[model samples]
Target: MTEESDSPMTDTDSTTTGPLVPEDITADSPFTLPGFFAALAEGRLVAARCTECDTHLLPPRPACYGCGSRAVTLSEQPRTGEVISYTSVNRPPSAFDHLAPITVAVVELDSSARLTGRVDASLEDVTIGDRVELQVRDPETVDIDPDFGLSYEEEWPIHVFELI
Candidate 1:
């Protein structure tokens, strides 16, 4: 009778290999929604522009919303923008309780793309039309994810903005 080993098996199922390691996860496309944001690690604020309608997509999409065109191009935008609107979170959510009194603002990028991000300013300092500059932040420091359905982690970059 042979004593069986409980160790992990290789592709050939020899069982001589130790525990199997997880496969490396990666994005499908460099211009995918997550991929665009991931570039922030390099201090870049990139967006997808529709080739047909010439509309820029902030979160990025495969198809253009204006004309339903499948042709999209990802590009970096001017790093400055004006604050369109904003709100403050005094009673923060579970993931942001440590960062209460956080001010979130919608900024219209110089290229006409609207992106929401946290501003480093007091309540009195923030106002509509105020010029703000993009500042890449360690995602954990910002502790907020503008991308709905995707959680922000320390490894990702947070495209934060500050009044200029």
Candidate 2:
């Protein structure tokens, strides 16, 4: 499949894959703008860590929410995590119309930080506490393009224990 220039990074799929975003949808990002895209571009799952409580926070920030510590550090997270909760967006927000019925999951990293992403499996197959791996899928493979550096999708293999 052809790759899109705007994708975070292209990954070869043994099977056919689809784009994560459609050209029709247009909306501003809801999360931290540059830092989010930058992490994907660099192939690292960046998160904020509290120096005081040692809490790893997703959506990296300048301060720690747990201990109210300003001394925070940004670190790359392990790509594997456990699915704490998830939902299939059959009716997505206006901006995600191109990707309706997508699976969004809250994943708990091994470090105990919870982060969210689109789940890359069928709705019937995903379950709470399922093991998942972070992956960067090319938009062109799916026939859509997100107006960002790259869009990522999380895939959960059948064997959940493997992630640990």
Best prediction by TM-score: 1
Locate the minimum summed-lDDT window of 10 residues in model 2: 154-163
Q: Tell me how many residue pairs clash in candidate 2.
A: 4
Q: Tens-digit lDDT track for model 2 on 89-158?
A: 9987665677678887888766667777887776778888777777765434442334532433222111
**Per-residue lDDT value at 103 in model 1:** 87
For all candidates, the clash counts are: 0, 4
**Candidate 2: misplaced stretches above 4 Å?**
1-32, 138-164
Clashes of 1: 0
- Give a tens-digit lDDT track for model 1, residues 66-146: 787756666567778789999898987666666678889999877777889888887789999888888987755565544
CA RMSD of all predictions: 17.6, 13.8
